[model samples]
Structure formats: structure tokens, C-alpha cells
Target: MKVDVQLLKDICEAPGAPGFENPVRKLIIEQIKDHVDEYSIDNMGNLIAIKKGTKNPDGKKVMVAAHMDEIGFLVSHIDDKGFIRFQTLGGFDPKTLTAQRVIIHGKEDVIGVMGSKPIHVMKPEERNKPSKIDEYFIDCGMSKEELEKKIEIGDPITRERELIEMGECVNCKSIDNRVSVYILIEALKNIKSPAFDFYGVFTVQEEVGIRGANVSAHSINPDFGIALDTTIAYDLPGAQAHEQVTALGAGTAVKIMDAMTICDSRMVKFLKKTADSHQIKWQPEILAAGGTDTSGVQRMGKNGSIAGAISIPTRHLHQVIEMAHKDDIVGSIELLIAALEEIDTASWEY
Candidate 1:
């Protein structure tokens, strides 16, 4: 099946910054409710959808996690002149915020721009330094009285960028994890006759930490776990060969390890074998820094789980113009479905 770019666009465009994941959570529920046997939102705002396994007599569960949240900001204060001070909800490169547009989700959605000092007035020494996060503020372009009517402190703010098709990829804000969200939804709908029951969890607070995945995985305690997320594709120019984590159009990533967790070896081998048997293109991922929901899924269970991850190779990650290849996106979905169907065939003994 081909990629559904429209559905992916809708998923990426929906704002759900860290703890403020209500909007995108709702969108995921709408798309998957009818496809799953059952689905529910947890107390911590994770959306869990379950599909019963047709072939399992052992009552095994496979938990697949895809975080629903994105890196964003929260209003901290509104200045007397209508400039707004904010705190970021997740990691951000300060320079990427320069003059970027954002949406403030308060009493109503209000648009603002990241305001910073113009280089024309900067001291010669200042112009050479990288921008600092604290040096920026939001410009609402409205009077303080008018701004107060629609915005206030603690309201969530999100990057403003629409998904667009590049030559061979999709570019948009929140592609870091939103592309994984799209993959999980498609896999849930497409997988038939899985080897074990599947718990498709669209998690929250992952951009902050794996908080939502930790809670949900603790509750599910599955026999197998796979975290679907994006990893850096430093395949761009001016990079050494060893430094490229993965590349656009390279294929779906089979996680070896990241800073937070070393993936279960058995699960890693199973993913690779399954992909080869199915002839799905694949790559190995070793993120030197950063992590995904894999950490929580691997250790939060009662006995811990045989966990790994399927990472989509993405460039300009955590930035507004994050990008991923459509081919890699489709490869991820294929590999996930193949794994669920063939899990019973793999040797799980370590």
C-alpha cells in the first residue's frame, strides 16, 4: 500500500506539545478507534489501542509505542508591551527559533513570532555568538490589553509549519515523532492475524522524557516491545561517514542502542531476520546521544521486556523543518507488520 500523505499531514499539523497533547491525541483516537478491538486514553493521556491476536494460545502481548507529543513551549509571562516570555517544553536548538512563527494555545489560538535582536544594532562581538534561548521573546503584534483577551500564562505554544512534500520526503514541524505516529496508525489498520495481541500506544510527554511510555508499558507488561520513533539522519554534507546515524531513503532503522538503553539483542536479531525474510529494506541505528520510548518499554515491565525500536531516519530533527523519506516511512510500516505476524516463528530464547 502507498503512503497516505494527507492523513500524515493532519497528524503532523495537530498541536500537542509535551504535556499538552490533547489535540493530537484526539486526532489519533478518531483515526484508529474503528480499526482496533478496543482503545482508551489513560490517566496520563496515553492512547492505547488493542487488537486481539488470532493465532496466540499463550496470551502474549506485544506493545508498540509511538509518542504523540512534540517539542514546544509554554507561556511564562506577558510583558507590559505585549512581548511574551516563554519556557520550552522540550529540547530545542536556540538558533532554530530565530524569527520562527508559533501558535499559542490559550483561551484561543494566537499566532506569534520568536522576537530577537536585529544584527544591525548588535555589538560586533555579539553578532558572532549563537543565539541564546533566554534572549528571545514572542511578539504578538498586539496591544497588551488585546493580547490578554486571548492568551495567558501556562498556555501551550507550538511551531507553525505545514507538512509539505519535498523531492523524496515529507517536511514539517513535529516530524521527529509524528511520522512514527502515522506509521503506528497505518500498521494497526493493516496488520491482520498477528502472532500475539498488540497494544498500539500513542504516548505523551516523550519529548520531555519517556514518561508516558513508562506508565503505559508498566501497565501493559508486554512480552515484546517496540518503540517507534525518529532518529537523526546526519547524512547531510560536511559530515564524516561514521557520523551519519542513518540516511534519508536508506530504509527503516533497527535500533542497536542509544544513550538511554541498549536494545535487547534477541529482538534486534528478530527484526533484522524478519526484514530480510520479507525483503524489507532496513538499517542499523546507534544513536550516540538521545533516546526514545525504548528505555521505558524495556525496563518498566514486571520482568522487563525483549524490547527494541523501529526508527525512521529523519533530518533536521526537533526543528520546524524536520524531514523523512516517504520510502523509509513505508518501509517502517511494512517491517512492523511483518514482525508482528512472524514473532511466533522467531527463536526468543537468549
Candidate 2:
């Protein structure tokens, strides 16, 4: 069965920066309420939804996590000319910050553009140097008095990009994780077989430091854990084959290691076997730079638990135009469902 592209689009386009995930949290709750057997929110805003197993209560508990927050900006100070100075909530490449449109969430929605000194007006020395984020400001086209009337010091700003389909792929902001969240939801909808009790967690504040996952893991203490997220695909120009990470259209990525955690080898092998037996497409991934919720869940319990990651290969992550193939997204959903269907306490070594 095909994944719902429109639903993925909706989730990616929603605004939910770290520490400000209420809107996206509500959207996810609305979508999964009818399908999940049980659901609730923890103190840290992690949304945990469960589908009970058909087997006896002795079955193992499996936790699947996907972060719901996106990289965005927080308003720092509004200058006299109504230009807004901001701080980034997550990692950002300063090279991508010029002339981009952003939505400043205030008393009312206000649209703005990132303003910088034009090349013609800059000194020759500045032309060769990359611009720092602090060097740019947002222009809302309002007077200083008018700006203070609506926006404040802590308002959030998100990239303004509508979801768009390009060939067989989809592109938009926040697909880095929102797409993975959609995959988890879709898999829950498609699974019909008996398996271990499953808890799908939509975690918050991951971009800030995996804060929600740390708390949620301690609460659940599952026997097995899997983090569904996106991995960078450097298959573009100037990228070498070894450094490509994972390629687009190469199927869902089964991560071996990232900066945060090294996946349990046994769990990795089990997932790979399950995918192969079920005819699900997959690729091996090793991310050199970043981490995910996997780290927190892996080391949370007494002696900890087995952990792994399933990733969608994405290009231009944390940007307004992140891209992922539809086929890879579908493959990830299928593989996740297959793994959950066959999960058992005996399969876990620890």
C-alpha cells in the first residue's frame, strides 16, 4: 500500500520548533486517537501512544520514537527600525540564511524576510566571506512602535515553505523528522499481525538535546527501542561516494552508528533479517556528524536496552527545501511494521 503523501505534507509544513511543539503535538494526537488503543502526554510533552498485543501480557515492550520538533529561530530583540534579531534554536548553515521568508508567531501571524546587506552595498572584503546569522536581521516592514505592539522577546519564527512534489520526491521544511513521524503513524495503521506491545513516542525538544526522549525512556523502560528519523544524503555535487552517507531512492536506511549512539549489533541484524524476509527495501547508514533520540533510550534503563535506528535518506536537511523519495518512506514503514510484528522477549539478549 502507498503512504499518504498529503499527510506527510501537512506534518512537514506545520510549525513546531523545539520547546514549542504544542501545535504539532495536537495534530499528531488528532491523527492517532482513533487508531491507538491508549495514549497520553508526559510532563515533558512526549506523546506516547500504544497498540496492545494480541499475545499474552508476558510479551516484551517495544518503544519506537520520532522527534516532532523542527529547527527554527527565537526572537531576541526588535530594533528601532522594526528589524528583528534572533537566535537559532538548532544547527543552521549560515550559507542558507539569505533572503529567506519566515513566519514570526506573535499575537497574530506576521510574515517577514531575512534581510542582509546587499552585495552591491558591501565592501569587497565582505563579498568573499560567509555571512554569520548574527549579521542578518528580519524585516517585517513595520515601524518600531508597530512591531512592539505584536511581537515579543520569545516569539518563535519558522521557515515559510509550502510542501511541493518534485518528480517522485517531496520537499519541504522539517521533513528531517516529521516525515519519519508520519511513517510511524502509517505503519501503525497498516499492521494487522500480533506482536509485542508497542509504544510509539512523538518526542519533543530533540533539536535542543533529546530532552523529551530522556524522560520518556525512563518512564517506559521498554525491552527494545528504535528511533525513526532522517539521515543526511550527500549524493549531490562535490560529495564523494564514501561520504555520500546514504543515497536517495536507495531504500530506507538502517543506521549502524551516528555521533550519539552505536546501534546494538544483534538488534541491527534482527531488523535486517526481518526486512529481507518480508521483502522490504533497506540500506545501511553511518552518520558522521549528528545524533538522535536513540542515545537517550539506549542507556536509560537498569543495564539499559537494545537500540537501533531506521532513517529516511534526506537531502538539504534542516533547511526549507529538504527532499526525500516516496519509495524510501514507504519502505521504512513496511520494515518497521515487520519488525514489530515479530518482536519477542526471547529475541532481546539483555
Candidate 3:
């Protein structure tokens, strides 16, 4: 099955930093509203979509979560020279911040360039060390008075980059989670009669923590949950063999364990079995660090629901030029659709 490249590009390009996901949420709702039976946004801004099963409306409830937020920054202080100092909202490699273009969401969308001192004038010790994030500032080419009039503290800041095709892979900012959101929407459009009542949740504030998933899972209390997100693929030139958590073009990753949760054994087996039956490529993911919405859903509800994840293998995760293979994206959608169709609570093992 061919993935929708256009939709993927749209989601990746949209701005939806943590705690500020209205732009991406609106786009998702517009695409999925016609396909679902009912949909609404939660108090925490999670877009909850319900697609009823043809067999039973009260059938097993299955929740599929894909966060809409991305790593970004917030304006903390604007100095006299119109240089903006920002507080990082999510984890960032200080190395990636220097010389990058950003969009500041203030009174109006303003373009700014991240700047730092030239290495030519740096001390020997300073040149050998990585630059601190605080040492950098954003230059909007405006005076202090002009900048203060259009911008204010607490405005969101995001890396500015459009999606680009790189051979078989695509590169852009926000691909970490937006790719999974694209997968979920595509699966919902293609799947026919599912065995369970499906809830496609576009969660918010996942970049900061799994806050949105935590709340939605508690309210839905799904029988089974699958969190869709991206896992870091260290298949690079310098990384060692054992350090490679996943590889680019390796297909969808079926989560075994991460820092957050150990996948339910039954869910793992089911996903592998489904992939084999459909001839969809897959891999086992054992992430050393990092967490996803899966942890939140697995521990939610009265008895806790069986939970797992289908992750897209991404290279240079959280960077402005994040990359994901197109084939792996399609594989994730195929595996998810197949698993949803076969979600039979009676047949699932304890």
C-alpha cells in the first residue's frame, strides 16, 4: 500500500509545540471527521475519535494514540537589542540550535534566525566545548521597541523547515510523532469492519510528558491500546552496532520494551503474527531510553489494558532534519490496520 505523502508533509509542516497544538489538531479533525462515527476534543486538547464496530456498538473498546505535539521553545526574555532568549520546552541538543531558522508564534507569526558568537573569536577552551543553549539568541532583524510591540514572553518557537524528499526517505522537523498521526489517519480511512470499537486519539503535550494520553486513557478505559510514535534509528556512520536501537528502512518496529513500559506479551505476539500473515515487514524495538503514550495507556483503567506500539524508525530524532523511510511508514499503516481487524478479546490470551 502506498502512503499519502501529501498528508504526511502537511502534518510535519504544521506547528504544534507542546501545550500548543491547535494548528495540528484542527488539520487532523478536518481529515478524520467524515470517517468517524463521533469525535470531540477533550479538556486537554486530545482529539478523541470513535468509529463504531458494525457488529456491536458496545464491543471491546480499542484506543490508538498518536501525539500531535513536537519539541519546541518558548520566549523567556527579550533583551534591549531585540535578541530573544528562550527556554527550551523539550530536550534539544545545543549543537542543533545554532544557525537554525525558527518561527516565533507571537502577536503574529514572525521569522527569526538562531544566532551565536563566531567560533573565530572564541577562546581555545570554549571552541573545544559544545555551546550552551543560553549562549544563543534569536535575531528577527527588528529593534527592541518594534520586537516588543509584535512579540511577547511565552510565545512558542519552532524550527522552520519544510518536508524534503531524500531518495527513499523524507526529512523534516516534527516527523517524530506526526508520521504516526499520518499513519493512524490513513489506517482509519482504509480499514473496513473492525472487531473492536476503535478510538483514534490525537494526543497533546506528549513531547513534555504523556499528559494527554494519561487523561484520555482513563476516560476511555479501552480493552486494548496501541500507541503510535517514532523510535530513534541510530543507523548512522559513527554509531556502534549494539548502539543502533533501530535501523533506517527496517520496517515498522513492534515494541518489546523501552524506558517507560514493557509491552504486553500477548500484544507483541499478535502484532508479529499479523505482520507475518500479511507479509508486512517488522522489527523488534528495545529502546534503551525514552517513553511513549503506551506507558500511560497500559497503566490506565481499573484492571489495566493490554498495550503495545507500532513505531516508525526515524533517524536524527528531534532534530530539524529528522528522517523517516517511506516504506517503513507504509508498513506501519498496514500492520496497524491488520491488527485492528483481528482484535478479538475472546481469543486473546491472558
Candidate 4:
């Protein structure tokens, strides 16, 4: 199956902070508006779509989720000298904020550069430790009057990096979960006849917390649930081999557990079986740190649903530039299709 390169670029490049997911949601809606049986945007900013099944007219409800939010900052305080101080919307590695370019979504979009004290002027003790995010300021190259006229407090800020194609990988901001959004949209377009009624939910606020998925899952209350997201690929230097979690190009990750929840063992087994039967590249994931929407979906309603996650191996997560391999991206969609095609025979009760 071929992945849509342009769509992937559009999703990754779109600005969608935790509570500001409209831009990304609009793009997703445009792509799958006609493909699904029905779809709607919830009050919590989730795009929930349903695709009916022909094989089992009375089958169970199967829910698939992918979050659309990206880590960013919100303008909190602006100094009289035109320096913009902001608060983080999601998790960030403070070290990565230095020297990065960002766009402030205010009355109008304004480009800004993160500024900090020059290293040459820093004290020996200061240079030894990493600078905190609060210590850095955004420079819009505008005077106090010009900045006050256009920008205001509470505006959202997003990374301004464009998607770049490496030899076999793609690098851009917000790859943490946009890659999965691409996967879900592509899988929905490709999977012609699923075995069970599918509720594909494009969620929000995943980076801040699994709030959107929690509300949507309680509302849908599906029998089976799956969270499509990206996992840490610490295959770079300085990371120990045993703690790599996952590797780039190692294939789609069958998440066993993460910092949030332990995936349903039955679902885990079924996914492995499907991947093997179809000869798809796969790996087991145990995220030592961090979580996903899988946690909220697994324990939503009365009896709860059997839940698991499919993760794309990613490098430099929560940074200005995150990376994912093309093979892993395509492999994730292939595995999702294969699993959905065999959902009837696959047991979820363990």
C-alpha cells in the first residue's frame, strides 16, 4: 500500500496545540468526510467517525483512536521591551527550546525566535547546567508598541519547522502523533470491508492528558479499543541498548505496556498473530516513561474495554524536529488493516 506523502506533510506542518486542534481537525475531516458512514466533532474537539461493517451486522463495537495535539507554548506574559514570555501547553525538553523558531498565533500569526543569553557571556557554573524554558524569551523583532498592537497574552505558540525528507526518514515538528493520524486516515481509506463496526476517533489533548479519548470512549463504550500513537526510539548515542524502548525502522510497535496502562494481553496476542500471519514487520513496546490515550479508553465505561496501542518508532520526540522512518509508517497501516480484517476471529476476552 502507498502512503500519501503530501497528506503526511500537511498534518505534521499544521499548527494544533492541546486545546487548539481546529486546523488539524479540518484537514482530517476533508480527507475522510466521504469515506466513513458518519462522523462528528465533539464538544471536546474530537473528530469521531464510524465505518459500518458488512461481515457482522450485529458484531461488537471496535474503537480506534489517534490524538491530533502537538506540544507547544502559550503566551503568558509580555514584557514592555517586546519580549514574550510563555507557558508550556504540553511537555517539552527545555534544552530543545533554545535557538528554536516559533509562530505566535495571536491577532495575526507572527514569527518569533527563542532568545537566550549568549554562551560566551555565561558564567562557568551557568554553562555547566541546561537552561530552563522560563529563562528563554521569544523575540518577534518588533518594538513594544508594534508587539502590543498585534500580539497579546494567551496566544498559542507552535514550532515553525517545516517537514524535511531525509534519505529514508521524515523529520518535522509534531510527528509524535500526526504520523498515527496519517496512518488512521490511510487505513480507513484502504480497508474496504472490516469485520466489526469501527469507530475511528481523532482525539485531542493527548499530550496534556488523555482527556479527549476518555470522554469519547465513555460515550462510544466500544467492546475493543486501540490507540494509535508514536513511541520513543532512543536508538541514538548515549542511550543504553536495553533502554532503547524501540528503534527506527524496526517496524510498528505492538505496545505491551507504557507509563499509563498495561495493554490488554488478549489484544496484544491477537495483534502479534495478525502481523505474523501477514508477514508484517513488528516489535514489542514497553515505554519506560510516558503514556497515551490507551489508558483512558481501557477503563472508560462500566465494564471497560479491552485496549491496546500500535506505535510508530520515533526519534527526538517532543522536540522541534522529530523523525520517523517511511517503512515503519507504511507498516503500521498494513498491520492495522490486517488486524481489522481478522477482528471477528480474534478473541478479545482473556
TM-scores across all candidates?
Answer: 0.99, 0.97, 0.97, 0.98
Query: Per-residue lDDT tens digits of candidate 1, residues 1-350?
Result: 78899999999999999999999988898899889999988999999999999889999999999999999999999989999999999999998889999999989899999989999999999999988999999998998999999998999999999999999899999998999999999999999888899999999999898999999999999999999999999998899989999998989999999999999999999999999998999999999999999999999989799999999999999776899999999999999999999899988886
| Per-model lDDT | 0.94, 0.89, 0.91, 0.91
User: Which residue pairs show backbone clashes in model 3?
Assistant: none
Runs in model 3 deviating more than 4 A are 56-58
Shift of residue 83 alpha carbon in model 4, Å: 0.6
User: Could you say which candidate leads in TM-score?
Assistant: 1
**Model 2 lDDT at residue 283:** 88
Q: lDDT tens digits, residues 57-163, model 4? A: 57778889999999999999888889999999889988998888999988889999998889999999999999888798999999878997887888899999888
lDDT of 4 at 213: 92
The TM-score of candidate 4 is: 0.98
RMSD of every candidate to native, in Å, equals 0.6, 1.3, 1.2, 1.1
For model 4, the stretches where C-alpha displacement exceeds 4 angstroms are none
Tens digit per residue, CA lDDT, model 2, 1-350 = 77687898889888998988988899898899988899999998999999988764776778899999999999999988889999999898887879999999889879999988899998999999989888989999999899888889999999999888999899898897999889888877778864878889999999989898888999999888999999999999999899999999999999999998999998899888888888888889999989999998887855577899999999998766799999999899988998888876335554
Tens digits of per-residue lDDT, candidate 3, 40-89, equal 99898999998887655666788999999999999999999999999987
Pairs of residues clashing in candidate 4: none
Prediction 4 global C-alpha lDDT: 0.91
TM-score of model 3 vs. true structure = 0.97
Cα shift from native, residue 169, model 2 (Å): 0.3
In model 3, the Cα lDDT at residue 308 comes to 96
The lDDT, on a scale of 0 to 1, for candidate 3 is: 0.91
